[model samples]
Target: MKKDLWIGGEYRSAASYNELKNPYNLELLAKIGSASQEDVRLAISAAHQAKTMMVEMPAFERAEILEKVARFLRDDLDECARLIAMEAAKPLKAARAEVNRTIMTYTFAAHEARRIHGETVPMDAAPGGQGSLAFTVREPLGVIAAITPFNFPMNLVAHKVGPAIAAGNSVVLKPASQTPLSAYRIAEYFHTAGLPAGALNIVTGSGSKIGEVLKKDDRIKMITFTGSPEVGRYIREHSGLKRVTLELGSNSAVVVDEGVQLNKVIPRIVNGAFAYQGQVCISIQRIFVHESIIDEFTEQFVSETRKLKAGNPLEEDTDISAMITRGDVERTKQWVDEAINNGADLRLGGSAEEGIFQPTVLVNVPLNEKVSCEEVFAPVVHINSFRDFSEAIDLVNDSKYGLQAGIFTNDIHKALQAAKKLEVGGVMINEIPTFRVDQMPYGGVKMSGMGREGIKYAVEEMTELKLISFKTE
Candidate 1:
C-alpha cells in the first residue's frame, strides 16, 4: 500500500518514501511519503488558507460534520482496528477499543460544537459603570499544528482534530512516523465528511524536519503535541507565543492500600501496567503498596503476569505485543538491568524473547533508579512497600512527572486525600491511572507538559476568549 501526503484535501506524491513495517515480524505494511521542507510549508499554507472558511462555518454544520465522521469510523471500526494493529503493533482487542474511543471522541466533539457559547458578564459592578453590559465569546485561533504519537494514533488524532474542527480552526497534522496509516485513514474520513479543502492536511515522515517548520511558522496559530518531554519542551521554547497543548511523558504511580480487594484489583493493575506493552503515557510504572498486604498482592500480580499471552497483535487472544521499535525495546531492557544492578528484585519475567519484552515486575526498587525516576515507557513495573498511608502518598508525589496516579482503597477519606495530595492531574480511586474516558479534562503537572486535552477543554484551549462591552450608560 502507498500513502501519499494529504495536502489541501488531495493526495499528492512525494519525492521520497519511507517503508512502514510491522513491529513484530518486520512485514512490509505500507510505503509512506517522506514529507520534505516544501511539503510542510505547503501544509501550513493550506491550513492558513482554509482558516476563513472554517471560521465562517456554522457550529451546527461543524457538529454535523463531526457526527458524520463518527459514523464513518463506526462503520469501519474493524478495518480501522486492523490498521492500528498492523502499523502500531497494538493488540487486536485494544485496537478495537481505541477505535471505539475515537468514535466517541468525534461524537463528543460534535456535542461540544453545538454547546460552544459565551457567558454574560456584569460590567456595571464598578463605581463609574452603571448601565454597561458585557459578555465574552470564544473565537477560533486559526491554524493549528497537531503532532501526534504512535501509541494511540487514531484516538489521539481524533482528540486534536475533532476538537480543532469543533472550535472552527484549521489543522496541519503530523502523525508519528511509525504509524502514519491511521492518520491517512482519518484524513480520508474528514474529506468524505465534506470538510473544506485545506481544512486539515497530514504530512508524514521525519519529525525533526517537519517539526522545525511547524514550531517556527508564524502562520500556524497553535501547536498541539503528544510525545516525549524533550520534544514538547523544544516546541514550546521555539514556538514563541503560539498556543500549545502538550501531553508528554510520565512514569505514573499507583498506591495499593491495605484492606483492598485483591481478586478484583490485581488484574486491573496488570492490565494497566502491561497494556499495549506499556507505551501509554499514563501506564502504571511505579507501584507503592501497603506493607501489610504487599505479600499477597505481589503473589497474585506475578501469577497474573505469567498468564498473559505474548504473540502477534493480529491474534485476538494475544494480550501483549512488540514495542514500537527495537530501540525502545533495548532501552527498556537497559533500564531494567540498571534497576536490578541497583538492588531491585526481579520478581517476574525480565528478559525479552523475540521482539516482545515479557511483562516484567520488580520489588524493592530504589526511588533514584532509572526505572523509578524516568518515564520508562515500557512493560515494566517496580513495586515498593510503605507502612504508612502518608508515606505512600509521598512516594507517589516524589516523581518529577505528575500526569496521573491511582489509589485502591475502601476508605472514603483516604481516596479523597489521595485525590487532593497526589500532585497529578487526575487521581483514580480504586482504579489504575490508565483509566481515561474521552470527554474528561486530562493533562498533567510538572514535567508532564502543559495544558489539558479533553474535547471541551481542548476546544477552550484552541480558541481565544473575547469580551464585548456595551456602554449604554
Candidate 2:
C-alpha cells in the first residue's frame, strides 16, 4: 500500500516515499510519501495562508468540527487500533485501549473549545479610577507545528492537533517516520469533517530535515513536540522566540510500602512495567519496595512476569509483542548486560530473539548504572528495597528526569508527605505512576519535559491571552 502526503487539505505524491514495515515481523505494510524541504515550506506557507480564516472561525464551529472527528474515530475504532498494532508493534488489546483513550481526548478537546475562558481584571478596584472596565480573551496562535512520536501515535497526535484545531489555529504536523499511517488517517478525518484546507497539513519524512524546517520557519508560532530530551533541547535552542511544549523522556519510579497488599498492587506493577513492551516514557522503571516486604514482592512480581504471552501483536491473547524494532531490543539488551556486569542480579528473563525481548526484572542494580538512572525505554525494570520512606523518596528524586512517581501506601500521612516531597510533575498515591486519564494534566519536569498535555491544558498551550479594556468616560 502507498500513502501520499496530505498538504493543504489535498493528498499529493512526492518523488520518493519511505517504506513503513511492520516492526513485529518486518513485513512491508505501506509506503509514506517522503516530504521534501519544499514540501515542508509549502505546508508552513499553507498554514500561514489559512491562519486568518481559522482564527476568525467561531469557537462553536471549531467545536462542532471536532465533535464530528470524534464520531468518525469511534466509527473506525477497530481499524485504527489494528493500524496502531501493526505499525508500532503494540499489542492488539493495548492498541484498542489507546483508541478509546484517543476518542476521549478528542471529546475532551471538543468540550475545551468552548471553555477557553479568560478572567476579568478589577481595574476599578485598584487605586486607578471609576468607570474603567477590563477583561481578557483567549486568542489562537496562528500556526502550530505538532511533531509527534511513534509511541501512542494516534493519541499523542490528538493531544497536539486536536487542541490546536479546537483553539482555532492551523496545524502543520510531522508524524514519526516509523509510523505515519495513523497520522495520515487522522488528517483524512479532518479533511472529511469539513476542516478548512491548510487548517491541518501533514508532512512526513526525515526528522532532522522536517524538524529543521519547522524550527526555522517564521510562520510557526508554537511547536508542540513529544519525543527525546536531545531533540527537545535542540528545538529549544534553535527555535528562537518561538513557543514550545516538550513532552520528553523519563525514568519513572514506583514505591510500595510494607502495609500494601501484594496481590492487589503486583498486577498493576506488572502492567505498568511491561505494557507496550515498556516503550512508554512514564512506564515504571524503578520499584522501591519497603525492606519488610521486598522478598514477597519480588517473588510474586517474577511469577506474574513469567505469565505474559509474547507473540504476534494481532493475536488477542498476546499480552506482549515485539519492540518497535530489533535495534531497540539490542539496545535494551545492552543495558541489561551492563547492569549485570556491574553486579546487578538478573532475577528473571534477559534474552532477545529478533524484535522480541523478554520482560526482564533486575535486583541489586547499582544506582549509577544506566538501567537504574537513565530512561531505559524498554521492557526492563530495577527493583530495590528501602528501609525508610524518606530514603525511597530520595531514590526517586535522585534521577535527573522528574516526570512522575507512584507510591503505594495505606498510610495517608505517608502518601501525602511523599506527594509533597517527590520532585515530579505528578505523584500517584496508591496508584502506579503510569496511571493517566485523558483529561488530566500530563507532562513532566526537568529533563522529562515542559508544559502539560491534558486536552484542556494543551488548548491553553496552543493559544494566547489578550487583555482588552474599555475606559468609560
Candidate 3:
C-alpha cells in the first residue's frame, strides 16, 4: 500500500516517500509520502483556512462527527489492528487492544464535545455590583499541531485529534515516521465521517522538517506532542508563546511490598514490565521489592517472563516482538552489559533470539545505571530490594522522570503515604503504573513534561476561556 499525505481532505503524493516495513520481519508494508517543508506549510495553511468553519460549527455537529468516527473505527477493528501490528511490530493482541482504546477515545470525545461548556457566576456578589450577570464560555484555538509517537500510533493520535475536533479546532498531525499508516488511515475515516475538508491534515515526513515549520507558524495556535524529553524540550523552547502540551519520556517504577500476594502481582508485573516489548512510556523499568519477599518474587517474576511468546507480532499468542528499530535492540544489549559489568545480576534472557530482544530481568542494579535512571524503551527491567515502604518511595522518587509509579500492597496507610510522597504524576496503589484508561486525565511531572491528555482535560487545553457580562448602571 502507498500511504501519502492527507492535505485538505485529499490524498496527495509527495516528491519522495519512505518505506514502512514490518518491524519483525522487514517486509515492505507501505510507502509513506515524505512531505517536504513546503508540503507541511501547505498543510498548516489548510488547517488555518478551515478554522473559521470549525469555529462556526455547533456543538452537536462536532459531537456527531466524532461519533461517526467512533462507529467507523468500531466497525473496522480487525483491519486497524492488522495495520498497527504490521507497522509497529506490536503483538497482534496488543494491537487489537490499542484499536479498542482508540474507539473509546473517539467515543469519549463525542461525549465531551456536548459537555464543552462554561459555568455562570453571579456578579452581584461584589459590593458595587447590581443587576449584573456574568458567565464564561470556551473558545477554540484556531489550529492544533499534533506530533505523536510510534509507540501508540492510533490511540495517541486519537487523544489529540479527537479532542481537537470536539473543541472545534483544526489539527495538522505529524505522526512518527515508523508508524505513519495509522494516522493516514484515521484521516480517511475522518474525511469520510463528514469532517470539514481542512479540519484535519495528516502530514507525512520528517518530524524535524515539519516541526520547524509548525513551531514558527503563527497560524498554529497550539502544539500537542508525545515523544522523548529532548524533543519535548525543544518544542517548549522554540514554540514561542503558542500553547503547547507535551507527553514526554518516563522511566516508570514499581514497588512490591512485603506480604503482598505474590501470585496476584507476579503476572501483572511481568506484563507491565515487558508487554509490547516494553515500548510503552509507562513500562516498568525500576522495581523495588520488599527485602522479605524479594527472593521469591524475583523467582516467580522470572518464571513468568520466560513464559512470554517472543516472535512475529502477527502471531496471536506473541507477547514480545521486535522493537521499533534494530538500534534500540543493540542499545538495550549495551545497557544490559553495562549493568552486568557494574555488578548487577542478569536473571533472565538478555540476548537477541530470532531478531527479537528477549525479555530481560536484572537484580542488584545500581541506582545510577542507565537502565535504572534513564528510559530504557526496551524489554529490560531491574529489581532492587527495599528495606521498608518509606525507603521504597524514596527509591522510586530518585529519578528525573516522574510520569507514574506503582506499589503492590494491602496496607491502606502505606498506600496513602506512597500516594502523597511518590512525586510522580499518578500513584497506583494496587495496580501497575501502566494502568491508564481512555477517560482518565493522564500526564507527567518534572522532566517527564506537562499538560493533561484525557478527552475533557485535552479539550480544556485546546480552548480559551472568554467571559461575558451584562452590566446595568
Candidate 4:
C-alpha cells in the first residue's frame, strides 16, 4: 500500500520518505512521507484556507458531516482496528477498544456541534450598561495543529480532530511517526464523508522538523499536542502567541487507604499498572498503600500481575504486548535496575526477553528514586507504604505531573477530601488512576497538560469567544 502526505484534500508524496515499521514484529508496514519544510508550509496554508471555509459552514452542516464520519468509522471498524494493532503494538483487545473509543469521540463531537450554543450576558446587571445588550458566541480559531502520540493513535487523533472539525476549525494533524497510518485512514473517512477539501490534512514526518515548522507558523492558530513533557515544554517555549493545549507526561499515583476493601481493589490496581504495558499517561506508576494493608495488597497485586499473558499484540489471548520498541524495553529495564539499586525491592516480573520486558513490580521504593518521581511510561509499578491518608496524599501530590490520581476508600468523606486535596486533574474513588470517560474534562493540573480534550471541553478550547456590542439611544 502506498502511504503519502495528505495535503489540500489530496495525497501528495514527499520529496523524501521514511519506512514505517510495525513495533510488534519489526516488519516494514509501509513507507510514508518525510514531509519537508515546504510541505509543512503548504499544509499550513491549506489549513488556513480550510478554516475559513469551515467557519462559513453552518453548525448543523458540520454536525451532519461528523455524524457521517462516525457512521463510516463503524462501517470500517475492523480494518481500522487491525491497522491500529499493526502499528501501535497494542494488544488486539486494546486496539479494538481504541477503535470503539475513536467512534465514540466522533459521535460525541457530532452531537456537541449542534449544542454549541452561546449565552447572553445580562448587560443590564452592570452598573452603567443598563441600555446595552451584549452576548458572546464561539468562533473557530482558524487552523489547528494536532500533534498526536503513538499510544492510542486513533483515539487521541479523534480527541483532537473531532473537536476541531465539530467546532468548525480546520486541522493539520501530525500523527506520531511510528503510527501514522491509522490516522491517515481516518482522514480519508473525512473526505469520503464529504468533508470540505483542506478541512483535514495529514503530514507524516520527523516530529522535530514538521513540528517545529507547524509550531512556528503564524497561520496555525492553535496547537493540540499529546506527547512527552520535554517536547511539550519545547513547543510552549518556541511557539509564540498562538493557543496551545498540551497533554503531556505523567507519573500518576493511586492511593489505597485502609478504609478500602482489599479484595476488590487489588485486581483493579494490577490492571491499571500493567495495562497497555503501562504506556498510558494516567497509568498507575506509583501506588501508595496504607501501611496496614501494604503487605496484603502487595501479595495479591503480584499474583494478579503474574497471571497476565505477555506476548505478541496480534495474538488474541495476549494480555500484554511488547513495548513500542526495543529502546523502550531497555529504558524500562534500566529504571527497574536503578530503583533496585536505590533500595527498592523488585517484587515480581523484572526480566526482559527480546523486545518484551516483564510486567514489573517494585516495593519499598525510595521516595527520591526515578521510578517513584519520574514518568516511567512502561509496565512497572512502584509501591510505597504510607501510615496515614494525609501522608499518602502528600506523596501523590509531590510529583510535578498531576494528570490523574486514584483513591480506593469506602468513606465518602475521605473520597471527597482526596478529590479536593489531590493536585491532579481527575480523581477516582474506588477505582484506579487509569479511569477515564471520553466526555469528561481530561487534562492535567500542572505539567501534565494545559487544556481539556473531552468533546464539550475541547470544542471550547478549539474555538475563540467573540462578544458583539451595539450602541443604542
Q: Best candidate, lDDT-wise?
A: 1
Per-residue C-alpha lDDT of model 4 across residues 24-136, encoded as one tens digit per residue: 78999998888898998998888888777898899899988888888888888877888888898888888888888888999999999998878888887878888887888
List candidate 2 stretches off by more than 4 Å: none
Give me the runs in candidate 3 sitting further than 4 Å from their true place: none
Give candidate 4's whole-model lDDT: 0.88
Q: Estimate each model's TM-score.
A: 0.99, 0.99, 0.99, 0.98
Candidate 4 pairs with clashing backbones: none
lDDT of 1 by residue, 214-235 (tens): 9888998899999999999999
lDDT of each prediction vs. the true structure?
0.94, 0.93, 0.93, 0.88
lDDT of 2 by residue, 57-123 (tens): 8888899888898899999999999999999999999999999988888889989998889998988
RMSD (CA, Å), candidate 1 to true, equals 0.9
Worst 10 residues of 2 by lDDT: 124-133
Could you tell me the lDDT of residue 287 within candidate 1? 92
